[model samples]
Target: MRHALILLSISATSLFLMSATPLQSQTEDAQSIRMNQVGYFPNGPKRAIFSSIHKSDTQKHFRLIDATGKKEVFRGILTKPEYWKSADEWAAIADFSQFTQAGLYVIEVQGGVLSAPFQIHNHIYEYALNASVRTFYYQRASISLDANHAGPFSRKAGHLNKSIPYHKDLGKAQNARTASPGGWYDAGDFGKYIVNAGVTTSLLLMTHERFGSIFPDGSLNLPESGNGTSDLLDEIRYELEWFKTMQDADGGVFFKVTPLKFAGKVMPADDPSLQHMIGKSTSSTLNFAAVMAYAARLYGDVDQSFAQQCLQQAEAAWQWALKNTSIRYTQGTKSSNYKDVQTGGYGDQHFEDEFLWAKTALFLATKDSKYSISIDDLPEKYSAPTWAQVSALALYSIILNEESFAKKVSEKAKVMVQQASVKILKEVMAHPYRINQMNYIWGSNIVPLNAILTLSFANHIEAHPVYLTTSVELMDYTFGKNPTGYSFVTGFGTKSPLHPHHRIMMADGIEPPIPGFLVGGPNRGRQDANSLKRYGGYPSQAPAKSYRDHTASYASNEVAINWNASLVIALSFLEHQRALSIHEPK
Candidate 1:
């Protein structure tokens, strides 16, 4: 592959201790500093957010204090605080990128404010990257988890899904059953949805394909950790195998395996809701075709027989999508929480992107123009990939595997990625937090990461250093560098989300939520109850500040595989960039 990146071997990363939620000892000081809570890289960019300081015009200074707070190894002047409209807060930035030493340290402001400790190292993000990837293992549906692998989060497998019946719309007998099993739960709920899985699964597979060295075998501590195969692939194969069952005899893929409504906050084994096929759509079928083709190419060497099977499945799905091209995911059962909207409905009426993606992926797998889309057929605009809109996924596939694509198609793909990258780069530069706008809707956290992913792809399309540097800043925004000043990830920071809106963490009797899961961050819309049950009101109505750390605040603090997949790949790509900066010495 022409786009094959230089492989970087990884060392074992040290464990990050789980700090007490809202660390009582440093609660007041913690608010004074905002940065990547995990740490900064020794040679990478180092910046932090400082607020509510400055005794005199000339005294706006911050010091890098050792973990003991007794020694000041470095000092830097704070930039003037800039007013950010979204959160209506003044934030000052301190740049200390010149400090290339590796150590644990904190920041000290003028008014006796201090930050929680963080590290500076070459492999600063390796552990978080591994954790983000391992979160998939925790989400596996079917089979029990042993303590050796799952540790404190071990649980008996639920959602056996051996005999899920089809809904009446499928025109099957009332007693007919199809067994679809062994994929991660889609979100905080117990639904196994294909429409959402389309973007999530493909991204994971792409990450593994591009950066295979970072996720070496046994790195993720999966059940198949040491099976002499990439643990990430082992995990992805489980989902792919489940995807195999999702395809009907005629090749259409079912939209989701879900009950009429979502389950309550109960353990997976105890969720009483019935699991069955909701429906199928053109979008889902095309998505299935694209991923199957992608899997066939990536897994060809790992499992020749399985790769051939996937290629066949991809062909069948392409034929099905050709016939059923306009099917939207309009059929959804009733849910108590949702009234008119389709519960768990990945409402997408647009199938052009889906069509292009399926064609591009099949082309990559087969190198056949019959399965390829012409550059003239592309949409005029390109956007960052979401489950609903994945035109970029197709373009990215063409861009990454340029050798397998026609020069015109490859150039067009690069132009599309760069077009989207320009918009995101402009926004990243304009925002005070070094992000795009606070798209603080449901799953708003993934917005910046989607930008990060696009920027990375654009970097691949045209190797510009600024593309990747901007991408890292967006990643920093997700961790703890944003207006919220909270690491949205469940367990990697000094003050992380303690109670994400995940049913398993709530019902599993665990005092701490599992590590590596990125919670849905702040949403301006307080659509969920303000003070539901044990949860309190959101801190503020400000779009950037409207977040609660309560399990009941599903509007803001929820976990989903789709969102986590973005986080995993962003971390992996950033780590790859860091590795290149080290080993390549360019």
Candidate 2:
């Protein structure tokens, strides 16, 4: 039955691919061609091509043509379709065996009934296959989709040689020469990718027994250390050094700061987003710091002084948060604390970022009697029962004073985990895309998944089968199997729809343009202009755009920093788990 469903899906995808129209052609017949290859260069002309449906009996042919019909770039024998799937959708493969560079392309069947043009931006492929390969072990490890078609961890217990190459390639491509000193291009507001890269690397490093490595100088590729016991002391050491380079003097890592602008304004020092650090009650920071600390311990031989310094910095940050309690958000003056300020100010208030994660970090860092008291006496200001906050609190309780806090947190974690399990399972059963804010299944969904892992580790609750099932499912959707790469865009207003394309026809009024180099966008051409009309008008009332644009400035940094921090932590957790599994008693 499963095989039949898969076959059916493939057929439907093929039909869909063959039926859509290409962007350049207006007539149905001309448009029916599917794009075989598409490529985009940073500052070069877009390129595209179409596959010929009717192959000559004597000749297998491939053709590349420009929009003007004046140029036929190159052609070769058509190759087999490259099959790949995203979270919810199956894509029919068009062969791109002939082309090498990036640009737009198209493919068509004989009837002219099926055609589509895709904008091929190889940056994603390059990042995943090139840059990541250099630094980490990728070839040995393979992400697995479990029975439920969800991802829990990379599968295959093997030597390092196989896995490290794949990851190193991906890292290298992702960090391919761009405008940032960090090597990787920042995803701007979607800076989670940066965290993802770091986390992925750390995990690979932690499990070095399963993934081999090539030294930075590329002098030699080493074999697996044999067994999982070859202490990842060196890998941990490197990670610590890498992390230090990521930090700022004030002890905060700006989510991303590059593409240097004239004002030298990247991420400002006082952005509320920086508050997501754990010592500051931001769940995101806490989670990352906790993972880092955990990694430090597991790897051992880490620079203890450096580790202590980081811990101290974290402590100071938390102290600052506690001391600066008066800087709460003013939602018409009803706010009591920063939590209230965040919930009232942000839409989808339930979505967890760094703030909620920090609570757990604080508890872990201090373990002091007063901190425990604060945890118990957490005021109504932090009363919101969002899953993120609940998860962080649950983890914090278990980590700080496990015996005392476990009973309550365990009960709560169980309830929340059950709820999320039901919600996610039902959605996946119905169809992956059936869930609202489909994107959330990838980005926001990670929070609940991490919470489940934390809760399980804390013994707050028995291992909930559903929690694992759902988490695996979400992971599979985003990073397992044939993962779909998300193209992120910046410059949207705070009120802008989460999906970039959705905001194209803004009904809201125009707002002041965001200050800086607007990265990728739907209206990539019009980002520099001051007025909405120049950018094909606002999605809503012109005034609403202005209002949203202006208001966006206040929360942008917080959103970026918090999300990035959270991602790093989540990745760290995964890496830690992998490391532990290496030495787990069989």
Candidate 3:
């Protein structure tokens, strides 16, 4: 693959730290600095800042030190202190974009604060992107990961279902195991869920749609790299193939395929539990409908027959959803034999979001008037595209599409985009870390990530520098610069989370968790039992201060397919922007 050379060169010499290095003990006046561990591209937008917990004015200069941690690489002057009224803290900004030399460097504050070393290069994030995408490959089930094909992460085939049994509601089960072979594990658990797949697949497709030039054929170094399609599309199709098998003859899709109980901490091949295909809810069916419809369009040029099949399945699911609109896949009632509280339920009471999303996809795919009416009628206020909330996704697809839309639908999209942009800007200004209250729930890191999508859409509608800057601040808070003083992404920063709640990382004896796996960031809710048992005693209820880096802190430490998909979208957007900068006339 074209990107492999760049990735290998950087990662070949990288050290896999077994644990996080402790931050230097803070003096009363010490200032804490934070930035992404991989640093910025030499020609890209670059900014980092120092946080002062005391809210005291830090009238000090900072320096960038070379790899030796002794030689000064660049000197930096501090900007005027900005008071954050919400957290009662002060932050000072630093911009060293003028220092364009490609090398490893660390930020050093005057009073004993030293940042983790980072690099500035043309392809610094190529490796991060590769590692992030490879996680999906690592999660592929029912396929033998040959050493020659999978490299160091090779494994035997798992979950090879020769036949599948339909739930009692659907019909009698198939006697022979139907092959639902390859798709990602939804999260830490070994479940393949359609609801989560809907968001994850769309984000990956968005990368190809928006940044197709970046990923040439053979760019991702996957086993299918040499295939006619782009590596990104190939990886997405690998999962889509499995998704095709998830639909019943009736056209409705199952919620997930998983064991009767959550598997223990074990390797994919070693988890010897029988997999069950369960749940046929409107939410899952509509989500399946949306993804399949959009994917049909994506696959049209590559494989027309498969594209037609996807559209057919999508239309089928849409029809099934209309007949059974109100059925929610409650955890315990979805399956008769297994009332799963152990695995992800992905259940939602509201179907309007799913309805609008499926309608948008159908409208775009076929230009059907029936679908357009519903698209125009979609509620103005809807949740961002979370696992349970996906109305924003429909808006994104509508806004990004070049096809003509009804005046009502177009006006609705613009209104939604502007309202979301304003909400994010207002909240970011109110908070010290620039993260909003919307991100204070479980898997909070994804909120800012989802906002980036919204901001990107808003940027497309009208070029707003504040929207882009706010997006950057969101990146800073996510990568580092938060109250926890740790980079939420594993294997990137000096002070990154080492113990994420990922089963393979925990049980596989990996030194650090998988590179580029973004941990669920600060969550004040602390809803998971694991998190409550470990960190609930902490007195601080401030949103940013509620995170812990332990593997048991599922609320704040678990990694998910949908979250990483969001990261991929953000990273690809930055990469695209960096490309634009590089090509600009001097």
Find the candidate with the highest TM-score and give its number.
Answer: 1
Q: Put the candidates in lDDT order, highest first.
A: 1, 3, 2
Whose TM-score is higher: candidate 1's or candidate 2's? 1
lDDT per model vs. reference: 0.80, 0.30, 0.73
How far residue 393's Cα lies from its native spot in candidate 2, in Å, is: 7.7
lDDT of 3 by residue, 1-586 (tens): 3434534543452442212223333443322666665666675445676775344555578887765446787887777677654333567776676777777766777765777666677776666666677677777877887655455456777677655554454455455344566788888888899999998998888778877676766776678877788888888988899889888788888888877678888887788787877777898899889988988988899999999999999999999999998987766655564455456787689888888888888888888878874344667684677778888788777777735586667778877888888898898766645566554778878888888777878878887666665676577666666666676776665578888888777787767566778888777777665545645443346766677777677777889989999988887776666554432112
RMSD of each: 4.9, 18.0, 4.1
Q: Once all C-alphas are superposed, what RMSD does model 3 give against the true structure?
A: 4.1
Whole-model alpha-carbon lDDT for candidate 3:
0.73
Q: For residues 162-215, what per-residue lDDT tens digits would candidate 2 score against the true structure?
A: 211111211235422312111222223212222333343333332342222222
lDDT score of residue 328 within candidate 3 = 75
Candidate 2: list runs displaced more than 4 Å.
1-301, 328-359, 362-370, 373-405, 430-432, 436-586
Model 1 ranges with Cα > 4 A deviation = 1-25, 53-59, 332-342, 530-534, 582-586
Candidate 2 lowest-lDDT run of ten: 158-167
